[model samples]
Target: MHDFKSNPQFQKLQGKKVLVTGGAGFIGSNLCEALLDLGVLVVCLDNFATGHKHNIEEFLGNDRFTLIEGDIRNLETCQKACNGVDFVLHEAALGSVPRSINDPITTNEVNISGFLNMLVAARDNGVKRFIYAASSSTYGDSKELPKVEDRIGKPLSPYAITKYVNELYADIFHKTYGLDTIGLRYFNVFGPKQDPNGAYAAVIPLFIKKLMNHESPVINGDGSYSRDFTYIDNVILMNLLCLTTENQQALNQVYNTAVGDRTTLVQLTELIKKYLSGYDPAISKVEIVNGPNRRGDIPHSLASVEKAMEMLGYEATHSIDKGIDKAVKWYVENQHSF
Candidate 1:
């Protein structure tokens, strides 16, 4: 296995043509920025179904970047986006448990159908490698303290099932069609560019946005549920590392992309409150509104990144505290939009 950090193979993707599906969303935008910084030619595809255009507006003039406003649910769109692309980073999907619970068909239409569209497109286009956005929700009902790769429980929600299904289809595509693919099962990833004003936004960004606006954030399930919130930079590094590594053993596999540490909702709220106080001591007045248990919500989630460490030489540099500090600062500066 190639050491992800130490190997010279990291530079192999420097000038490659990379396609980032959903390149206008939080994670996809961040990934696109990283790729642009590395001198990679990036073709960003998004339908704006759930992604915002402002996310990629900053890169509009870059000679190395091209933005195609389209959806992956359409196979022709996926094929056109994959044409001449050297590698694929599939991050496009409709995400959120509550949203999925309310509208399972839309989630299925986008997540599963859209994912299949990209996989087939990448395969037919003869892309160098296919890397996709898998979810930690695949751990599902498995009561393991720190989730490992091979073991999983029944999916709790339609969203979870869609993500887990991505992994399954990706595996099948690789084995049956002789393709190379890697799945990064992200665990509550958060950082700059994360959307906070949405009805189904993720917790960290949402809470930070709420606190910045002097609003009391809800503490679902008494704020006891914990998570391993991974930072975007770490995710960017993992993707870059995985895309270039020549380890045959690492292909056709899924790896947990997280810091491998758990923080409870109460503790997370306290941390956010502490950071926000720097802006306005009065902002500290934001209190938790304890609510009924959320449907399809897991009690706790932490990842055992041993597989990533051993096979991909992946190491998380930021702790949950560090990620929160950075994310909170971004939300503070962009409070009005929230």
Candidate 2:
């Protein structure tokens, strides 16, 4: 969507084979679509535990797109998906802090054990680079503003601990196994195809869906909590950079994939209302309710994109305002599908 063809660096990915784990989920599905557009062979490995079928229905017919209905928890499945792949974009993981807190065992099994399986599979199969979806939750309880890669606090939830373990495993893989790896520590990524229905739904999509139905959307706290709400397209760019960049200094490093800006929960809701109002003016009048802040919730989360920009030549094409407009439009048009 960002005219990826304009970048000569990305041109190198044409005709390459890529395996995107969790390819039926929000971020993974979007990545699959983008790679197919570049004429890259895409193998989507998903178990559909959290991923939806319709998310990948469109790509199912593409000759270049292959879907492997399997779970990463199975080393054999991961081994099969990694075979003949040029690079691995590992996006599979059980997301959400509350969900992890609800059942830490399942989360660990998928996020940690599953991740190790993929790493071993990729290493054994000679995959060129293994790029993974890391989380801002890895910052944990750290109150530092504009989180940098070098600085991090202790993990606050089981989900955060699993993601931090991903970073550790990746580093060890690079050091001991000689597998190229890059960890993209994503902020609050939201966009089209993001599931709005579920107990562990993200704030943006959940708020958008409630407001669209004129339902009262509840905030976890007094609405002072903030996040570096990043758009999906910007995230896509970060992955493409990690996949194709030949910069030796960039490999085996963790970069914050974000807009480098923060928006409060209250501000985010207002912006969503402002954009959705264009389609249904009544949405602007929806009421927001306050509830007790959930445990393991961070008060504020922001990112420093300096590492990405300097090493990967990355630039965020969408700010929060621009991204919200596009996402609201998508949800409005696709509401009937939901």
Candidate 3:
């Protein structure tokens, strides 16, 4: 979507075999689709626990696309998925801070132990690179304006701890096992195919659903807390850069995979309504309510993209406003299914 074919750097991945774990999830499915567009052989390994089959239904017919139905928690499954793979994009993990708070045991098993199993499998299989999905939650309690790659604070939740542990594991694998790895700390990524019907769904899609249904959308706090609100296209570009870049310094380093911007919850709601109202005027009249803030949520979060820009020549193609406009149109067209 970002004219990936024009970038000669991505030509290196044209015929490579790439494995995308959690390939049935929102972000993973998008990556699989893009890789397939580049004529890359894609292997999608998903247990369908939190990820849904609907997300990957379209790719089922692609001859170059393969789906393995198994859990990452099992070492055998992880090893099997890594076999004959040239590169590994590790996206498998139980996300959501509140869900982790409610069920920390399952979260730890899937996010930490499952992640370790993947690393071991990738190392044994001689995979060229392992790019993983890290989280901004790792910046817990830092109160920093623009989150940097090196600076972080104590984890605020079990989800945060699991993600931080992922960075540690990747670093160790690079140093000890000689495996090439890169970690991308994502911030509030949202777009099409993101599920809005879940107990722990992200704020943007959840709000869009409520407004479309003509129901009042509830804000978790006083509507002052903010996020970087990265778009999925930007995330796809960063992963592509990490996958194909020849820069030696970029390897084994973590990057903030986010737009260098922040938007308050209040501002985000207004943006959503502004876009959706064009299709249905009633959405603009929907009320917003403030409730008690959720636990394990940082008051404010933003990311510094300088490291990604300097190291990988990364650029954000879709700002939050442009991303929201595209996402709202998609949801409106697909509302009947949800």
Q: Per-candidate TM vs. native?
A: 0.96, 0.99, 0.99
How much is the lDDT of residue 268 in candidate 1?
Answer: 90
Compose the digit string of candidate 2's lDDT tens values, residues 1-338. Answer: 56777888888898999999999999999999899888899999999988999999999889999999999999999999999999999999999999999999999999999999999999999999999999999998888898999999999999999999999999999999999999999999999999999899999999999999899899989999999999999999999999988899999999999999999989999999999889899888888999999999999999999999999999999999999999998999899877
Model 1 worst lDDT window (10 residues): 1-10
Per-residue lDDT, model 2, residue 144, is 88
Instruction: Give Cα distance to truth, residue 289, candidate 2, Å.
Output: 0.7
- List runs of model 1 lying over 4 Å from the truth: 1-9
* Cα lDDT, model 3, residue 194: 90
Task: State each model's C-alpha RMSD to the native.
Answer: 2.6, 0.7, 0.7
Question: Number of clashes in every candidate structure?
Answer: 0, 0, 0
lDDT, residue 45, model 3: 98
Query: What lDDT does each candidate get?
Result: 0.89, 0.95, 0.95
Give the CA lDDT, 0 to 100, for residue 215 in model 3: 93
Clashing pairs in 3: none
Q: What's the lDDT for candidate 3? A: 0.95
